[model samples]
Target: MRHYVAGGTEHGGGIGRLIGYILTAQPQSAHDQLVTDTRGARWSKLRSPPLLWAAMAVMVKDRLLAPDRVHHLHIAGRGSTARKVILGGLARGLGCTHVLHLHDFDYASDFLRRPPWQRRAIRALFRGADRVIVLGERDRSTASDLLGVPARSISVLHNAVPDPRQSGNATLDPPAPDAPARIVFLGQLGPRKGVPELLNALSHPAMASLNWTAVVAGDGPVDHYRAEAAQLGLSDRVTLPGWLDRAQTRALSESSDILALPSHAEGMAMAVLEGLAHGLAVVTTRVGAHEEILHDEETCRFVPVGDVEALARALADLVAHPETRAQLAMAGRDQYRNALSIEAYIGKLDAMHRSVSRGALRGASAQRGTV
Candidate 1:
């Protein structure tokens, strides 16, 4: 068996990193080959230009049709501009099984806003694939509507994370109970992340009732966000830690009581998953992927997007009710283990590949009028 997995790199705390790691863990032997095309991933973008070009060439070569060899093709996160063109042509040329993984909802949004010539080309690229994999039902429905694909063509695969277990590094201690309850935001800090509102919300009546310290652990448009926090007199309350490695971020999650992110837009938040993995309850908005996983008063508490008062109230609820925090944490940990395990994810991927392969064989036989 051969498996080809391709996707984005971990940029601070993106879901792509987790996906890449999960794919790499798949069983590989001397006979079974695994090829990864990370040409347009975050790591490749930082490498020398010549090496990047070479990697792209290699990816294109690997993606080409191989007669009699069952190919499991995955296009995810970022690929070259010619990636879809090459892969689609390969599928048509060789009729190999193809899988298109949609990480962001931007593709369909672009197809709608762009001119007809561009939209037609984009549509054709998506139409050529045998299957499309998405993180949740929301993205699946949106992609289907814009691309004119049937629900059957799309598979809703929940983003998988490692079974959340405590990294028993004795030196790493949970935050002191006497210290302010830690509130962490773990993503690129930009306008889109709702940093300004988070800052403003810190000064709200409900938030003022509790003692909390904020840790912002990502880099992007930092100057503006820092300035806003200072202007709101939240400089002391918020810590702009710039960026943290995975281990460091995990430590923060284990130590934190509340994972606060009032994102204006998100497909799904891997950080929220990470928070759950570490047994930290979440406080996020209702839109995007949050609605898919979280139930208010169940896994975590939620408020409407952009409502600072509501966000503050939710935060206060967690702070004042320590038992609630403990309960949510336990529930979130269970959710991650039961539904988003690496074992479950790999099983799903394997099923998709086999189903597509079998369907392809059946179609070829039918076209030849073989009963």
Candidate 2:
């Protein structure tokens, strides 16, 4: 069966790179049938609306030419209005089975705020899919309530990363108490990632006693965040390295003692998964599917969102106690091996694809009988 994976192409964004990884891992038998339809602006810039529409037109035409051969369409995106429209059109026009893979938590909240007619349109888009995939059970419930689709129709699939053990650089040594703890934050630097709050936490008097150095990785408004760090009196404690390539990122992860991401929203962060895979002690907010995978104070430390004091306390505690960090790191690595590895995720995805294809065929047969 032919399968088409459609999503963004930007390297910085998680969805696009994830699609690439999935495509690369396809079984040899399915490789010939696998096609990728990348949308959105390359290099993380916005594309004009007409260009996006034209790209969709081309993708639709390609699928229509081999409608019967294409058994499954996996549409991965953040569920914007345009994305919904494109997905709905492809499902109807190609007469193929499709799965809507959600990558952001804001979609449901945004749907709730839309007008009645627009809400109906959004619901229709979800209703037309053979299956809807979310990052967690929380998102599955939200999708059912917001899109009016049955809970049974949604599947919870967490984001995963390649096992760091395979890289042969997974850190096994416990952090040395005499050295400053290394904290690393990977992803865009902005309010959505809780950057301002992180700065505040670092500036708090509680953290003043702790010996820690933070490395802010990835791109987006770097100068602004750097200035904020300086303004918060954290210039000496923080380092902004801008964006790093894959190898650089891996090296940084391997060397770091703690992985910090106080995000306000997420579907499931790849950085968090990578941190777990590398056996690093993670300090993050309880957003996305994190709570499902990470046990607070066991596998990782969880702090309330935007709470400077709580975040500062969490950081300080981890810094002061190397034994606690080691325990959490080992638990995190075990969690990665048991649940969040790429191989495990691919096994689930393969099963979902087969189910979706079978259902699509049955639906087509019923439509013909009705005629």
Candidate 3:
């Protein structure tokens, strides 16, 4: 089968990062993905976003026009639904099957609470998809209930990341006696991700005496958040270095002792999975599919969103006790190997693509190309 994976750039954040891993990190198999840029060209910054989306539609239409049985898997969310609904229709008309991978952090509140017409648009996209993939059971249930998609049509696939473990006698390797504990936050520097709350938590008196440093890495309003960090007296210890390259990110993951993401919302955060894959002690909020796989104080440390005090306490505990950090890190890595690894994710995705393509050939014979 001819497989096409379409989405944003790797630097675009969670959804983009997921597509990046699928296209680059996984081992070569029959399911290798041909790629396209739905978000836009590298110089798309100069043009309006809607024009770039139009460009994506043209790309999708071109692939569908090909003679092969195309299995187009689109990974996007939010306003991306608008263009995808059109592309989904085109895929059907062209006798090809498309899998709509719905990945949005705010589907719990923002999407479900949208006005009636907006909700209808989202449901229409779900209806046209030959197969619908959701991040977890919460999203699966939401699609079945609110979107009116059948329960069987929606598959609950947990998000995953490529394992970054290296072999050595590096068990619980903390920094030297004089070096500070490293805390890393990987995500957009925005309100939904709880960046302000993270800064506030890091500035709390509980962490005042601790020898610790933090790197809040990713793109978005860097100057504003840096100013907020300074206002909270975290300018000395906290470093917001915008977005890090793949090498820089791996280096940060390898060295950092803790990964913190106190997000207000999420759909199985890729950072949490990456932290688990890297064996870092994960300190995250209880929102999204986190509670599905991670147990509080076991595999990870769960904190409440917007609660600076709770977040501070979690960070302080991890920093003060190296043994607890080691325990969480080991358990998280074990969880990653057993459930959230890229191998497992790709295996299921390949199966889904095959199933949807076969269904299209057997049923949608009204058009040319697919059979």
Candidate 1, which segments miss by more than 4 Å at Cα?
Answer: 1-15, 24-56, 63-86, 105-107, 166-176, 364-371
TM-score for each candidate, following the candidate numbering: 0.84, 0.88, 0.88
Q: For residues 1-371, could you state the per-residue lDDT of candidate 1 as single tens digits?
A: 33333333343135446655565555363244444443444455564344435544544564463443445444432343235555555555656667776665244454466678755755676677777777777777766887766778888877766653633552334556667788899888875676777777777778876878888778777777778788888887888878787678777776788888888877677777778777787888776667777788899888777888888888888877777888997898788887767678878877887887788778888999994
lDDT of each: 0.68, 0.75, 0.77
Per-residue lDDT tens digits of candidate 2, residues 229-306? 998888999999898877788889988888989999987888898899888999999997889999997899999988
Instruction: Count clashing residue pairs in model 1.
Output: 0
Output the number of the lDDT-best candidate. 3
lDDT of 3: 0.77
